[model samples]
Target chain A: MTHAFYVALSYAASGIVVAVLVGWTLLDGRAQQRALKELEAAGIRRRSAARDQAEKKA
Target chain B: MSEPIPAIKKFSDLANPTIFLGLTARIVPFLAVATALMFAFGLYLAFTTEGDYQQGETVRIMYVHVPAAWLSMMCYSIMAASALGTLVWRHPLADVSAKAAAPLGAGFTFLALVTGSLWGKPMWGTWWEWDARLTSVFVLFLMYLGLMALTRALDDPAKSARVAAVLILIGFVNIPIIKFSVEWWNTLHQPASVMRMDGSAIDGEFLRPLLVMAGAFTLLFFTLHFLAIRNEIWRRRVSAQRRLAARMANRES
Candidate 1:
């Protein structure tokens, strides 16, 4: 029950919590960003196809 | 063709999701690096330092415990401000930031409590107490939980944001109480060391690391907050696109 032990434990615990949170946020952001990119690309492709069809008719 | 000034101005506005995301993405790296560097330096200093004349090694707990407590309060304050902005201006980003910050603030509050208890066990000879500071912090934790629950309970984003914002504003009353608990009432928790009528009770050797760790935690919170908001925005965008696709499919059918 020395002071050093308590101090060390507190620092370690805080560090671990922060690290895990950061890691989780990064991973979640990457996944969501990728999904959004895919959706945006798909929307653009659909628009281009509709434009091509209209031009062909003209 | 050259873009018009008005168009560029509009594009730079916070109302634009793409612009917000782009700005947040660019800042995230610097915040992350600063957080990491500060934490490393703080930990090194905290470990290398000697025990206090009175408190011995347990004094080291002050470095981590105090900074976490500071962050817990700081995060709650930010949440309250964002909540206010959401309610008044109906800022989409403000709501998202407030919602994303709740769990993180709660996590910091939890750390403050747990580490406080651990530090207490060694010094105060008990793990639990009903002192004013401790009780107020416990109440803060409950408020964080309540705000989080309110955020999730409503299905509509606008409704959720409004309700949660109100709850956060009301809960903010506890923050000042938690801060002044040590002075306003007799509490088992010690009085303020950093903020005092005279000066800081701590010496320079310990104060440096504590300040560094506090800075680090602040940076860390900001970095995580930016990333979380980014994820939330993306999630909403994808959902909106899916809804639009479903509607178009139904029309074609």
Candidate 2:
């Protein structure tokens, strides 16, 4: 029936939007986590180098 | 770090991004599952239903159009609450909540307009009208855009939060106006069917799936909202760290 088509269309639109938004959020979240990990790694290296230099001078 | 011992914490402790992010992460999955299940059931109900005697198959558009309109209003209300929380409690997560909600709200509003137009063309024999309800919803869309623009335009996050809070609060006044526009003015839009004082004008066959779809959309919004806010907080944290690194590099140079 014609009613069936409209119903299908509505659900399809809702599904598409929800999928896109969820996908974008997951991808962005993963990128941020990766960036945070890299920053923390670099910070640890810098701190260790600073400590080594201080001990050598002493 | 160990959890703070005090049951009641200072403003800064409550506003901590890590605490907010952890809580949101735990809740998001449940909401997502609920949304998916609800949508599936709603779709099944919608597709299996018979058309109205008068409207024929076009009555099916009501399932989507009505839910999208409900969500557009719901998202704005949530955004207003976040705006209030940000201003009153100075909650860091609240600003992120409002910012994340704006685009989603706009998307819902856009969906409402498009779906309404599609439904209207079949029912009213025209694609567009300058009716009060339509105009008010258009204004709401504009308000959503304005809030998004204001949030992004400011260089300072703190200032952006404050200004956006004000804008959201002001824009909320339009919501009630939109809801009442049909009652207050002559319009091509139909009067309230499901929300009437006596009873719904719509029969159970059409109403059931519409209600289910509305619930599904609401859950979907909340799930996405949580993820969006979490990502925003992480983004801010990463940006802050980058700035700190740049400052350190300058000092060494």
Candidate 3:
């Protein structure tokens, strides 16, 4: 392969790796957020939030 | 009359997941924007700037290769510190950060190895080399993969975190080996240019773009890291809630 091809491949590989990392991180964040929101809607609260609610009631 | 909001006093307040999640939510968007802008300007400098008379157009690969290599070791170092936090302090976010960093560190190491190989083929006349620097980095890469696998192998996330933290600290010995391999031994890989005892060997023309690319890559790491940590935190929350739900169902039954 030509030098240019090698250079291009390097950049392309780096780009693809970076894109995948960013996509996975963002999508995973969104999915986790959705799952937590679903749980909250089901009347399940995070321990801290549950504590705050208990304090408010008392 | 209403009382004022309480001020956060302890440094451990920063370790609170809710506080961390809130802070990351506020900080990540700006970091993402900065990364985008840096990549744009850095690429412009990379392509438009004059090529190395020695390496010619092939020198362009260094912009990405060096930064990825830098981050590979940097991520490991960060993981090592986080590992200490996990064991010594038992800070909650410490394990979370260490867990989140593994895949990203692996990604950067993979990039570094791939780009280094590609660059080597043209310059060194071979794609594969068993030189000290190359071999040590490959070891570091394997260590990263091992840590990731260990983190996922167990059913209990807490158990996995402790196991992986110990592994990360053990694996950190490779990082310094990777750094000094070129100087400590005769290797095909070039010695440090940007970082050195005397000073950087690179010319200003190349250094400018290289610094920009490095900054861009660092920002990208942080942006992805914070996002991943947030996801891990959310995952834990869901798991906790599920266990709670299961307990409630058991009691009702």
Candidate 4:
């Protein structure tokens, strides 16, 4: 491969890796958020949510 | 009687997973915006910088390669510190942070290895080398994968966290080896330029963009780490709810 091709490949590889990392985290975070919301809607309270409510009432 | 804990230590309460998630939720968006801006400015500078006398256009690869290599080691150090918090301090967010970070660390390490090899093929005329630097970095990548797998292997969350924390601490020893390998041995890999004990050898033209890119990458790591930890915290909540339901069902039966 040409020197330019090697350089392009290196940059491209880094770009793809970073894109995949960011994409996966965002998608996973959205899915978990959805699940947490559903559970809360069904009356299950996460410990943090419980604490926040208690502090508010106090 | 023991002296009362200092006020600064009181701030450690932020390590509570719930508080951490709330704080990170507020911070991630701002961090993401800053990282994106930095990347744009850094790339503009990188492309405009005058080409190296020796490496020509190929020198452009350094902007990405150096940051990935730097982050690979940095992510591991973050994990090592988080491991200490998990094992010694029992900080709720510590295990979550370490677990969330392992995948990102592996991705960075993989980028470092692939880009290093790509750059190496052009400069060193070979793609693979058993040199100490390369080998140590590869081992670090394996350690990342191993920790990820070990954390998932056990059904018990508590057991898994402790095991993974121990593994991360053990793997910390290899970091300095990776950092010093180029200098300690005759290797095809270049030694420190920006991080040299003496002043950095890199020219100002190149160093400015490099530092900007490094800052962008660091911010990107934090943004992703925070999101991943938030997901992990939600996942634990779901698991806890399921266990609670099961216990209630058994009691009713």
Give the whole-model CA lDDT for all candidates, comma-separated: 0.81, 0.82, 0.90, 0.86
lDDT of 4 by residue, B95-158 (tens): 8889999999999999989988988888889998999999999999999999989887886778
Tens-place lDDT per residue, model 3, A1-58, is: 7778987898899899999999999899888888888888888876767787789999
Provide the lowest-lDDT 10-residue window in model 3 chain B.
B1-10
lDDT string, candidate 4, A10-50, tens digits: 87898899999999998987887787677767777655557
Estimated TM-score for each candidate: 0.88, 0.87, 0.95, 0.92
Off by over 4 Å in 1: A41-58, B1-12
Task: List the candidate 3 regions with Cα displacement exceeding 4 Å.
Answer: B1-10
lDDT tens string, model 2, B168-238?
A: 99989989988888899999998888988899988898989989988988888888888888888878877
Per-prediction DockQ comes to: 0.49, 0.36, 0.88, 0.75
- DockQ, candidate 4, vs. native dimer: 0.75
Clash pairs for candidate 2: A3-B57
lDDT of 1 by residue, A1-58 (tens): 5666777788788878777777878888788767766866766223433565688799
- In order, how many clashes per candidate? 2, 1, 0, 0
Summarize candidate 1's per-residue lDDT along B60-88 as a digit string, tens digits: 78777887899889989999999888988
Docking class of 4: medium
Proportion of the native interface contacts kept in model 4 = 0.83
**lDDT, candidate 4, at B9:** 40
Number of the top candidate by lDDT? 3
